[model samples]
Target chain A: MQDPFVRIEGVSKLFGAFQAVRDVNLTVGKGEIFALLGGSGCGKTTLLRMLAGFEEPSAGRIFLDGQDMTGVPPWERPVHMMFQSYALFPHMSVEKNVAYGLKHERMTKAEREERVRAMLDLVQLTQFAHRKPHQISGGQRQRVALARALARQPKLLLLDEPLAALDKKLREQTQFELMSIQERTGVTFIVVTHDQEEAMTLADRIAVMDKGQVRQSGTPTDIYEYPNSRFVAGFIGSITSFDGRVTAVEGEVSRVDVPGLGTEIVARSVAGAASGQAVTVALRPEKVTLTRDRLEGPNAIAGEIKDIAYFGKDSLYRVTLPSGQLIAVHGVNAKRAEAGRPDWHDKVWLSFDPAAAILLTE
Target chain B: MRRRPIFLISVLCFGFAFFYIPILSMIVYSFNGSRLATVWGGFSTKWYVSLFSNRQVGAALLLSLKIALISATMATILGTMAGIALARFRRFKGRLFFSGMVTAPLIMPDVITGISSLMLFILMAEWIGWPATRGFTTITLAHITFSMVYVTTIVQSRLISAERDIEEAAMDLGSKPWQVLWDITLPVIFPAILSGWLLAFTISLDEVVITSFTTGPGNTTLPLLIWSKVKLGVTPDINALATIIVLVVGIGVVIAGWLMNRAEKQRDRDARLAYRANE
Candidate 1:
């Protein structure tokens, strides 16, 4: 973040009476893969389009590498986009598509061909260079779109829902492939995606947008662990939150009286929360431990195991407290078959460390 | 195949007989050796030979072909520009009115279009003093004015189904608006434009009322000549000319159909390739 390569300054877009993006400001560093992650109709795509010069902000300004992008046409800007549909020209071959942007550059024919070959090789599509887009699979088409967008060597690249079309396996594989490509090319990428996991895996930093405003902007870990609002916490991952009031505040800890848990829980004290203030205590499933051993803490409670969703490497155990509220706890299935594992309807003790709970007062 | 109902079969036969009987009779009478009208004679190729060498037929045919070709090409260009403007430029002053005017000629009666264009040409001649003689140029202008409507409709409908992302992608890749149009938009809609040209060409070739209104002395198109000849009296040579016209047009249609089929086959192959790509 030393040098801000792409800076969006108080950008806002309005479609007649509807405001699509509202007072959004962000800065992306060079060679960093930044993500604008949000759900549908959240203005994530709108912000990305504004950066690519497709839609000029109705208010505010955008700067790319110290150059003002206002009033510049998409073709004149030093940024390219990979559309969600990939948008490969059906009439053109893969090589031709990758080489499309190069035709206007002041390069020799040989240089253009060499650059195209290098790009095709980078996307691992050299063998299908002569094939049309429909002649290739969807995964290959996605790579072709990537290769085409990167061929121009612009100051930045915009990718909108880059891997939404692929199956789960291909999406996961392409997520890493995209990161590797970004590393190799050193081109700043602004990826817009609805998939939170995609943003977490592919981006160095993410801006989570909702309802035309940015909720939080930070690294993946920072946003997941230290979400500023309940919306961000719920949107980013699965977590059980309790409506509570802070009963007491001690050094670095707060005792919250949660009616949902019907217990006083000790959690990490969040800034700006005082005694008698309303706060929401959020606990992630993986942070809570399901054990039979006696745990001595206000954060511990005895509950009956209601359900268990078993994965190969891990299992999610849902325990219902006497207050009739269920809390999810994840346990790693390390041993092949454990002897003393609690079954359905078995009483179990659920404990979470005071530091693991996220206290929000928004 | 299951046996079709007698009523359906009879209706189909009656419909086809109603259409093809005139053409069949015309073809059959073209080889008549007798000079008297409606008199049957021995088979002979004299009318066909004479029709080929007739100077008036040649002149009219050449003029019709020239006007049709020029008008079709002009209509395709102008109509495609209008179509792209309507499709790409979503909002502009008088866009609705402009689009309405562009498509109005499509449903306008041919007589109205002909008379209006004729009056407009007269006014232009008196005011601007250009096109002093209304012959090939006047006929061509009138044909283009009407045929461009069909072209615009075709191009616009094709573009409705076209993916906007391709053109946006081209522009994002540094292609200017005009360049994007030329490299991406036009190619994507080339088939539509081509079909439009063919439609315009065929329309112009056979348009009788419009041609009759706009044409000047000594500038007879084939349709006008045929109309005049049939008015005078049906001749074996006229029948021969009709047969030749049908043969040429039928061959062109067959070729077009074959080409479209081949394109469809290519798409089928692409589908097979897509299936294979899974493995």
Candidate 2:
């Protein structure tokens, strides 16, 4: 069997007394746009630096395309990094900046110029080729950085916070541009960003890291729907968690008595589930349905609408349960002009399916 | 309103007069037809013509210029390396001491620096018999020692403000460490180095105290010559030489300031442009 395009074998890094990255193992397929998502100082940037050969791992090894890249320097490695600051050569023109990496290659002057021209065209900055970095707009500079990093056609491209510098509207636009460019080039990309939405939109798979450890690695939907730990659940999306103990274990499901909602909840059984084990029942806000009448069958809780936050397309309702636990319920704003919507202090029923409750053991 | 306007104008005039009166008097007397420097005489170009004819002054001027040019260039090279070492290597064992020693010359008295450097050169000569005698070499060495501190300060500040990630990015894009330094680091800090060179040149050209201690019989720089001539009382020809020196140094300083200001303004304009682009 062919090995993965990039294989990180238990890589770890130590800076003086602080361990920045710890025992990280990952395999990325060819042409995959993988994202390392985390908050500040979670080892995402450290891992990206290691991949670019800027930092050497204290333990284990990294293999790229079946080659051991243990002692390779950054210049010799067939990897390029797009820095968060863009780091475009301020003294050089955009065309020159794009052509800089190509200088090391044994190409003729005409071939180098032709390659730069084609790269600028690819990033849609052909007109700004002669302009210096400071003369162009920020978005244009970002494109110049992208064009430069892509000019050499590296086997692996690392993007550090690729869209973090742009405004929201611009970020959204560039996210699509980045994905399309990656698709066209077929180069394996590993993006490191603290922005979860950016990672979800851009990456085919994401590794959520915290405290120098990978908490979870999966598709965006898999991470959101089936988080293995409480940290992953809270990091990926908005979740309301309740402390409970398993009261009964059935064939494929379990019943948990949650004192917070003063109800016995039925949820899909997690592995190693047994009677009288402490667990957490995490539910996404959008999974719950709110109605004025009491919900029939199981998994219904009696509560009152404590507060309401109205977004343009949706309203988030904070419901206070009988046991004083406030759980959030997100409902679509299907009705126009303040009709058939629960107001503050109105009694409501929050209901969800048994399968919607994620049973997290960790 | 009348009192405020009158007060502001008086203050402005006083500041200008206090700064320019001495230089103005010197310039005016440089064209005096009389031999006495302080007396008002008819304007003539005779002192200027005599200044060109004075071979001693010509020799001293050339010597000072050569020393300044050579020392400033050498100081720039050494100082930039020291600056990069201090700024980039954060946790080296003796970094604090190294930085302190580099900056010590900035605050040290010129008399002490001159005495210490002179003693060291004398001791080295006695021990190794290398320099043989104190002359242009000792004076140039002395100038380089003190002037390097200024260059180091300028280049160090520039290196501190410059993003090191730029160098890292260059390396990541298929350039070695040396290549990154040449292609990214040096070009970014070139402006500061240039201004530092000009400052060192001016300082070396006009230095009198340290040069006095380091020079031997034949190594009389322009400043040393001026000092000796002034001891015998100032002359109109001396005034002519001073005026010429002032013009040259002033032009050099103005060009340096203009270059620094232009670089600063260009940076500001680019920053403002980037900020507006975000909006």
Candidate 3:
């Protein structure tokens, strides 16, 4: 079997007494766009820096393409990083900036020029080649930084918050551009971002981090659908959780008694779950359906609409159960008319499939 | 409605008149037909010709220029290194003391600086038997000592304001530390270094107090020459020399100011353009 393009083995970092990253082990396949998703100070950036060789791991080792990366300086590492601020060389023109890294490649002059031309064309900034960084737009400067980083055709590229500086409209547009560029370059990418939507939209796989440790690592859909812990569920998206105790265990399902809803919810059986074990049933808001008609079976709960928030395509309803617990339910406005839509203080029924509810042990 | 502050305008006018009248009169007097400075006999170029013929003042002017150029260049190199150290290295042994000492010369009185420099030179000459006599070498050293402080302040502030990530990005792009310094850091701070050099040159050119204590025979700068002549009472020749000095220094200052202003405007324009383009 071929080895992973990049492998991080039990990496850890400490700043003085503060542990910034703890025992992180990850692997990235070739030409894959992987995201390190977390909030500020969650060791996402620390790991990226370690990959770029800016920070050495306090423990463990890193290997790139079957070679040990220990004791390698950043300049000697076969990696490049697009800094968060797009740190373009302000003194150099866009063309010169793109060519700056190529100076060390030992290429012929004409070959170097051709590489720079190709890079600028790749980022679609050929028109701004002669202009200095400050003379260009922020988005244009970001492209210049990308061009410069990719000029050398690094084995791995690390991007630190590439779209965080862009405005909303520009961010959406740039997201597609970034994906297309990655597709064309075929370079393995490790992007660190705090925006969950960005990670969901951009990455093939994501590692959700908290504090100084990895909470979960999987494909975006896998992480959203089946989070192993409460933190992962909360960090990925909005979820309404209920306190429950396992009442009975059947062949492939477990019956959970939730006092909050005064109902027994049938869910997929969790590993190591006992008959009386306490657990949380986390259900995404969008997974539950809201209607005025009564729902039968263990998958349904009756509630009254306490509040409604209209959000164009979808509306979020806060439903208060008979037990006085408030639960959120999301309904898509698929129909044009509001004739049968539930409003505030109206009776409603929330129903979900047994597979839609996630059982979290933590 | 807002008031224009008429009283403030009058105060500003008074300050300008007080400062400019003497220099203006001297300039006007340099073209005097007669030797007397108080009464300007119709404009003539006689004193200007005599001033050029005076070998003493000519030699002094050349010496001052040479000293200023050499010292300012050396000071800029040394001071820029010091600035980089202070700005980039957050912690080193005696960092606080080093920064304090670098800036102390800027605030220290010229008299004290001159005396201290003179004493050090004398002690070095006696102990090491180097720099046998205090002449051009001593004066140039003294000028560099003080001029470097100004350069350090300017370069340090520039480095502080510059983003560190630019250099880091260069390193990540496969350039070594020395390559980043040469290709990235130096170019970014070149404008500040230039202005610092000009300032140091101006300060060294007209310096009197420090030069007075440090100089020995045959090291008379332009200001020192002008001072002795002034004590003997002002002459049309001296007036011509002062006017010439003022004109040269004025031109230098105007050019330096223009360069600084242009650099500032270019930076501002780039920032504004980048911001507008971002949309």
TM-score, every prediction: 0.96, 0.94, 0.94
Pairs clashing within candidate 2: none
Q: Rate the local accuracy (lDDT) of all candidates.
A: 0.92, 0.91, 0.91
DockQ scores for all the models shown?
A: 0.77, 0.65, 0.68
| Model 1 TM-score (2 dp) | 0.96
Residue-wise C-alpha lDDT for candidate 2, range A87-206, written one tens digit per residue: 999899899899999989999999999999999999999987887888888788889999999999999999999998888898899999999999999999999999998989999999
Provide the RMSD of all predictions against the true structure, rounded to 1 decimal.
2.0, 2.4, 2.3
lDDT of 1 by residue, B141-183 (tens): 9999999999999998899889999999999999999999999
- For model 3 chain B, where is the 10-residue window of minimal lDDT? B1-10
> What is the DockQ (computed on Cα atoms) for candidate 3?
0.68
- Listed for every candidate in order, the interface RMSD values in angstroms are 1.0, 2.1, 1.6
- Residues A72-168 of candidate 1: C-alpha lDDT, one tens digit per residue: 9999999999999999999999999999999989999999999999999999999999998888999999999999999989889999999999999
Q: Over 4 Å off in model 2, which ranges?
A: A335-339, B1-13, B124-128, B255-279
Query: Model 1, residue A123: what's the lDDT?
Result: 93
Candidate 3 residue lDDT tens string, A1-362 = 16888899999999999999999998899999999999999999999999999889999899998899999999999899999999998889999999998998989999999999999999999988999887888889889989999999999999999999989999999999999999999999999999999999999999999988999999999999989999999999999888889999896889999885767999988797779999999999999989888676568898999999999898999999888888888899988755678888998888988888998878
